[model samples]
Structure formats: C-alpha cells, structure tokens
Target: MTERAIVAGVPVDTRHWIGGRRVASPGTFTTTSPVTRTALAEMSRGTALEAEAAVAAARAAFPGWAATGRAERARILHAVADGVEQRLEDLAAVETHDNGALLRSHRRGVMPRVAHNFRFFAEWLLTLGRDDFATRGHTNHISWDPAGPCVLITPWNAPLMLASWKIAPALAAGNTVVLKPAEWSPLTASLLADIAAGAGVPPGVLNVVQGYGEDLGRALVSHPGVRRISFTGSVPTARRIAAAAAPNLTPLSLELGGKSPLLVFADADLGLAADLAVEQYDNAGQVCLAATRLLVEESVAGEFTRLFTERAERLRPGDPREPGTDLGPVVDARQLERIDGFVRRALAAGARAVIGGGPGTGDSGTGESGLHYRPTLLTDVAQESEIVQEEVFGPVLTLQTFTTEEEAVGLANGTRFGLAATLVTGDRARAARVAAQLVAGTVWVNCFFVRDLRAPFGGSRDSGTGREGGGWSFDFHCDVKNTVTAPKGWRDHG
Candidate 1:
C-alpha cells in the first residue's frame, strides 16, 4: 500500500523540517515531485535569516544530548531501529514514492540495509572500546566526547539509508543532528523527525531542514553552532560545502561521487559475472558504487559482453513499485538531462551501444512522471573518454577489455574517484591480490554493491574523507581526549 503522506499529520511540521517542537518560523519552501513535477508538499526552506533559528535549536539541544551518557544515546538508536521495524512498510513506501527506487529492492534490499545500520551502530554500544594506555602504571585514559551539534546533508540516491549512515551513528555517539535531505527527495527526511519522536528522542536532538543547495545548505554549513558535518553527494557540492564550513573550522565527513570499475577476468564464472553486471545497474546506476566501468579480460570479453548485454537489455523499466520491475526511472529531470547528455557525447566521441542505449518511461501519463532513464551500455570508449572518466551517475555503463591482470588493475585505478571497485575471478589468490591493489574504499569479488553494516566503509583519495560504520563512525562523531593524571614521582621534570 502506497502511503499518501499527510505532511501536517506526521507530527513533524510539514511547513518546517523540524528545527524542533514548539519551534520553526514562518518561512518555508515547496518541494515538487519528480513523478509529476507537481507540488508534493511544502516544507520550510530555512533561509540564512533562520540560520540563528537552526543554530539556536541545535545549540539549545546540544549540551543535554551530548552530555547524556553513550548508553542512553545508544538506547535511543536502538529504539529508532525498533521503530523502523514496526513502520518498515510505511517508510519503504515513502522511499519508493519519493526517491523512485524499485520497491523490490527498497523493501527487501535497502530497508534491511538500513535496519542493519541501526542495529550495527546500536550493538557498538555494548562492549564499546575505550582507548586506555598504560606505561609504568601511569594509566592514560582517552575519553570520547561529542563534537556538539552536527548537520548532515544526504543525497537523493539513497536518502533514508544514507541518512541512517549519518544519523544512527551520530546518535549512538551522542551527537544531535540537523539533516537536510535532497530537495529532490525531502519526503523521507520529513518523516525522519516523526520516526525520531516515536523512538523517544527529545525534540531538537534531530532536525530536518529542506531547501535548495544554494540557500538552505549555505545557511546550515555556515551556521556557527554546528561543529561538524557528514555529507554524501557530488564533488562540486562537497567542495562548496567544505569551503563554507572552513571559517568555522567545522569538521566534516564527506562521501562524494564515484566512477567505480567492475573487472571480469577470464577465470570468473561467466554466468555469475553476467548476473553481477546486470544487477549492478538495476538501481538505474544511481549508486555511487555502481560498477559503471566494466574491465573484462580479452580472452573472455566476448562471452562476458554477450551474456551481460543480454541481461541488461531484458530489464523491464517501469514504475518501481510495479511487479517484475527490474529497473525504474532516474531521480529527477536535471539528472535525466545530465545522464543523457553524457551518453550522447560519448556516442559522438565514437562509443557504440552494446545492449541497451535508450530512454525508459514511468507511471501512466506524463512522460516525465518520474525521472526514468534506460539502462545503457557503451563500447569503444577510450581510456580518456569523458564517460569513462567522469561520474556518469546513471544507468549508462561503459564496456572495456583488458588483457593482463596488471592491465585490469591499472585501468580500474585510473579514475580520480576511488570510491569502490568490483572483481569477478575464480582464482581466489589472484582475486584477493587484485582486490588489494584496486584503489577503492570497498571491492566486491564475484559480486558488486554488497554492503555489510558492520564493515568499516569509506573511500580513499578524492572520493572524500572519513569512514562510516563499525568503530570508525563512532570516532567520526566524537573526538578523543587523553586524560593524563600524574602518579607520584611520575613527573618528567623529576
């Protein structure tokens, strides 16, 4: 059942993105749905005028929320996980509707992924490691203290899950958050405040502000009270956000774009390689970890191409909620234009369509009902081709063949984006060795885009800074302070 959201009734303000209860000013912004380009709902746009408002709310709540013991904060996150379990259906529907992800994956795949995140962070509280070092019985204990108020700017590709990536751990580590979801997908962010309330989180501890990047984001990033930021999006935007937060010296954890590679060696199971290739683009290749680059061994390139192309073309693109829908629409119109433009330029530069290289549609009328793009594949792309080098964040994938294992690794790491890579090989030793050499934060062998919440996930190089999940995320939200109490006769001066 698709949830027709009553924005006002959701307990969080539809007009405002929840600066906190008994709060929020008169200013607001209207977010339209990509499915219809019609008004979905209106939420607070949060201008710089409200900069004081957001900062005040976060500042007011910061001391109490931060001072609360880690156990209490972890309990709140546990409660959030429980609430997610109870309203999984509602939240899933909201995600599918607002973000246009295939319900099949959003329900079974993404939601479970989110549940795992909350659970993983929640479980970290138990047996939480504290840094204590001993030298000559002069114990030096390191205390983890919250960095105070935080602002999370999440992308539309996986708003709820990514927000959970920021939200769960921040809460677990005793940091209050004010997240601004992509205006293209504000519905779920709107619901987050309600979910937190149900989980017994106090008002102002979690806030959601919706507006365009130029305005609301500027306000949030430049706000004085915010001590840190956790963002997942594009490099350009990350740069801008980083610049804005610079003067304040606010720490940030940024997870920005990728042009990931999927290597299929001659020894890889052809059927499995085909399966991974096809599944890799199912999210309309919106995933930052999407295997948009296919590096195949020349010996088996033909077989891999034949099998993978067949699966890619056969994908039925339609309403994500519809049955048997293998792929759905892109996120919005601008993304559609950008993705298609990249594909066109690639073709003009001599690339050829391998399997699918067309457009897809969405729900009944209005061709632009939802942002939809066809699953496209291109061959004959050069190493320096823009499509190969740039982050073509769509269902468009490029196919290339490499002869040697060294060549495969070389081509895979050639990109400036070092977010993720995939290797499909049956030789366990070679696969392990290649996976090690690949310059990516995460690598999948024989599979792609498999995420475990307990794993330490992050990127290297320009893919942006800091790790999320596991113990690393806890540290991302808190700074360690060493308490050195001198024992008798322990003074170095003596």
Candidate 2:
C-alpha cells in the first residue's frame, strides 16, 4: 500500500526505489522528524527479499553501466550534479526535517557539498588514463575496471552528503550501487534515486532501500552478489558487517567511529582555537570526525577554556526549520537520552560541567523540543573516563591540558581512534612536525573542519579499514590489472 502526503511542506513518495521504479512493500515503518517529533513519512520497511531484489537489479544492470565510456559517464554525473542543484531547496528542507540539521546550514553547506562530490569525481575521472609503457623490446599496459555491483550503507548524520561521497565515486568508476540509507533519514536518498534516474542513469544503476540495519543491512552485506561493501557507522556495527562479508570474501571499506582530539598550542591564536572548539557543537556534535576532546597547552589552557565556554553558552538550540537556530535537536529522543547519560556519567566521575551542562528542559524560549542539549563543556575529565574515551555523538566536549608537545601528541593518540585531528599553532615548522607525529589520518593545522574532496580520507586503527575520496575511492571501486607483452625478438627488461 502507498499513500500521498506532504511532510514539512514537501510531497513525499512512501515507496522504495528499486530497479528504477517505485516499490511499495506490504510492510512499512513510520519515519518521524527529529525537529518536530512528528511523522515525516511511512517508508517501506525493506526485508531480505527486497535487499536481494535491489542487489539483483544492480547485478542485472552492471554489464551495461560498466561498459559506459568514461566521457559518457562523466556527462551523466555532471547532469546529476545539475539536477541536485535544481533540487537544493527541497533537498535541504527534507534533510533538515528528517535529520534535524539546521535548515540554513543544510542549504548553505550540505547541499552544495553534495553537488560538489558529484562534479569533483566526474571531472577527476576524465583526467584518468590507462598506463602504457614501452622500453626497447618490452611493453606493459595497465587498466582500471569496475568491481561489479556494490552496496553503500550510509549513516544518518550527513545523510545525502555522505551518500554522495560513496555514490559519486562508485558511479564514476562505473559500478552499479544499491544504497541502504539509515532508516532515520531516508528521505533524501529516495529523492536522490529520482534525480539520478532523471539525469540519465540507466534503470537499476542506482537503488535505495529503507529499513532497520539488522534486517536490511545484514541482508545487503551478506548477499553473495554484492562484490564491494562501503559503510560508515559505529564500530560494533562495522564488526558485524565485516563478519557477514567475510564468508563471501567481499571487498569492504568502512569509515567508523572516532574520539578525535583537537590540540591548541601556547603560541596558537587563542580566539580562533576557541571558535573552532565551539563549532564542534555544530550538527549537535553528531559528526563522526568531530573533535570531541580538547587538549590545550597548559600555558594557554585557562584563557582558551574561558573563551570556549563562553562561546558554548551563547549557542541557542532551536527548531531546525528556524533560520537563526544555532544548534538543532539531536536526531531523536533516544540520542538525547544517550547524550544525557554520557554527561551524567562524566559528572559522577568528577568531570565538571563548566557550561550549559545537562539536558535541555525544552522550556527554552525558542520553541525547541525536549530533544535538545545545550552545548556542554566538561573540565577535569579523567583521561580514562568513558565520556572522554568513548564516542560521545552529541553536543558535549571534554577538556584536558598537556604541558609539552610530546605529551599533547601522546594524549591525542591515547584513544583507539585515529580518524582526524586539528592542531592550532602559529609556527609552521612546529605545526608540520606535530602533525606528522599525530596518528590521525587527516590532520589540519591552524584550522578545523577544512576538507578537500581531492584529499585521501579515512582513519587508522579502529577508526576505519580503508580510505575514501579522490583517487583512493576510485582505486577501491575498481580493480587494477597490468598486461605485459614483449616484441617478436625481445629479452626480459628486468
């Protein structure tokens, strides 16, 4: 059964996109808006059968999609980017409504970034050429080919943007995809399916399935037909997917959790460091690469903490639909409760709540719901405390101080995660030196949250297994083969 309804002023089609068509299942689940706690849409609750069907669709379409020439694929991807631009307003609204991201930020940041992901890889692939080398009597040639049908499982935190990160590269590499979007935020993924098909993507080249991870996710990962699986989520879930994919010997790429740290040196710009610290609360601190721990040089710790706490205090949590809202609610009431639990445990273990400490009373004058947490700053938190070491995916930050550069690096790498880090320092040489020692995959000097799609992105240790973005993703989605030949009367070049 299917129903027509308007959610957050946008019309919604409560059906799954499979085989380039709208698929309505007998079973469905209601998706509620995190901002209003109201039903956004009734999405098809996908099952093992649907998962298999979507995979079959991709498998069926793989030969044709993989046979597409590079220029033709680039043209189609560019068209998809243009289509995303046209739907920016509706996409942003749907994302904010379903995922609780601020409307203005979604419009200003997320939408453009999604479009950029498509255009970047689309153009980048054009520059890629096969390798051919000839030396005297010997010749060698190397080529890249698609890795067959792949499954992309994206998290809820930046739904469409993260999906684009995986989807654009896979398609650019000529791999058909079965996208399993988080049930909490499936609206934009569905819309993306429509946009892609309209952009001249062949039927079954892209499909979207919606449901809980246990049912739909397990089915998709373990499906024998899926050649590659790229996922972004928690470590525990990554482990589960890894186990499932193990039986099939499927290639996997995972970008998992992070307890990333931010280091501020004595000679750093304290004002800018403090501003970046406050910006950690952006997206309610639900980002995977969020610098949740602050390691400041002892010499400048006091001033940095004061400025940081002041900025955290000024953050106003409000409805995501409002233009001036600084912080929106966490994804839902469950996340709100989990955030509260982290704060409570931190307080019990001697961490001081220096600013806007506990859960939101929801009585704040901004018409915000109860699912809000005022930006929280924790001081005197133990290095071993759960709140400090674990992934607290909320608007809460923990603070600690280190006296020397060595100690700062040590403290930063103490956690199992090596996803990302930021170092703020005035000296260029010192910045380079410390960044080299830091265990994180991507280190930023004098800045926070700076990203280039052309750069390699992923983590070390438990953070993730492989990298994404730029040529790394291209390499991941495709298989490399080298062919060697020798002239009629040739000897070994070696």
lDDT of 2 by residue, 1-494 (tens): 55545766778677888898989888999888888789888888999989999999999999999999999999999999999999999999999989899999989999999999999999989986666898785788877799999999999999999999999999999999999999889899988988998899999999998898889899999999999999999999999999999999999999999999999999999999999889899999999989999999998999998888777778877988887789899998888888999899888888898886777778658858788888888999888889888998998998899998999999999998999999999999999899999999889787878899888999999999988888888889999777778778656699
User: Candidate 2 lDDT (Cα, whole model)?
Assistant: 0.90
Candidate 1 residue 395 C-alpha distance from true site, Å: 0.4
In candidate 1, stretches whose alpha carbon ends up further than 4 angstroms from where it belongs are 1-13, 17-19, 22-28, 361-370, 489-494
In candidate 2, position 107 carries an lDDT of 91
Q: Candidate 2 — which residues are off by over 4 angstroms?
A: 134-136, 489-494
Q: Per-residue CA lDDT of candidate 1, range 323-350, in tens?
A: 6777777777788899989988988999
**TM-score of each model, paired residue for residue:** 0.93, 0.97
- Determine which window of 10 residues in candidate 2 has minimal summed lDDT: 1-10
